[model samples]
Target: MVTIRLARFGTKKRPYYHVVVTDSENPRDGRFLEQVGTYDPAKPIESARIDLSRVDHWVGVGAQTSTRVRHVLNDYRRATQAIA
Candidate 1:
C-alpha cells in the first residue's frame, strides 16, 4: 500500500521531516517515491510547507496519510484559510 508519511531527518535533538510518498512496508526515513512537503517542528506549525496540489493528486490516486501528516495538513489548511 502506498502511504503519505513523514521521513525524519536533521541532526540529533533538532528534528525535521519530509512528507513523502512510499510503500507502507518501507522503514521510516528509508527509501521513498517522492517528497511532497517539509516540516520543521522548531518553527511554528503554520510554517510547515506542503504542496497541496501534489498531496491532492496523491490522495486521489489512493495514498493514505499518516496521522501526524493529517494533523499538519489540517493546521496548514486552517492557517491558509485564515490568511485568505
Candidate 2:
C-alpha cells in the first residue's frame, strides 16, 4: 500500500524530515516515490512549510498520512488561518 510519511535525514542529534509518498513496506528512511513537503523540528512553528495542494492530491489518490505528519498539517492550517 502507498502511504504518506516522513523520511528522516540530518546529522545525529539534529533531525529533519521529508514528507513523502512511498510503499508501506519500505524502510523509514528508504526509497520514496515523491517528496511533498518538509518538517524541521529545529525550526520555529511559523516557519514550517508544506504543500497542501500536493498533499490533497496524494491523499485523494489513496495515500495515508502518518500521525505526526497529520499533526503537522493541522498545525499548518491553524497557523495560516490565524494569519488570514
Candidate 3:
C-alpha cells in the first residue's frame, strides 16, 4: 500500500522531516516515491511547507496519509488561511 508519511532526518535533538510517498512496508526513512512537503518541528507550525497540488494528485491516485502527516497538513492549511 502507498502512504504519505514523514521521513525523519536532521541531527539528534534537532528534527526535520520530509513528507514523502512510500510503500507501507518500507522503513520509516527508507526509499520514498516522492517528497511532497517538509516539516520542521523546531520552528513554528506555520513554517511547514507543502505542495498541495502534488498531495492532491497522490490522493486522487489512492494514496493515504499517516495520522501525524494529516495533522501537519491541517495545521499548515489553517496557518496559511489565517495569513491570507
TM-scores of the candidates in the order shown: 0.95, 0.92, 0.95
Error of 2 at 48 (Å): 1.8
TM-score: the better of candidates 1 and 2: 1
| Candidate 2 residue-wise lDDT, 1-84, digit = tens | 888888988999999988889999999999899898888988865687788899999899988988988888899889888989
10 residues in a row with least lDDT, candidate 2: 42-51
Clashing residue pairs, backbone N/CA/C < 3 A, model 1:
none
RMSD of 1: 0.8
TM-score, model 1 to reference? 0.95
Please, what are the lDDT tens digits per residue for candidate 3 over residues 4-53?
Answer: 99999999989899999999999999999999989999899888889989
Supply the TM-score for candidate 2: 0.92
What is the C-alpha local distance difference test score of each model?
0.94, 0.88, 0.94
Greater TM-score among 2 and 3 belongs to 3
Q: Give the runs in model 3 whose Cα sits over 4 Å from its true position.
A: none
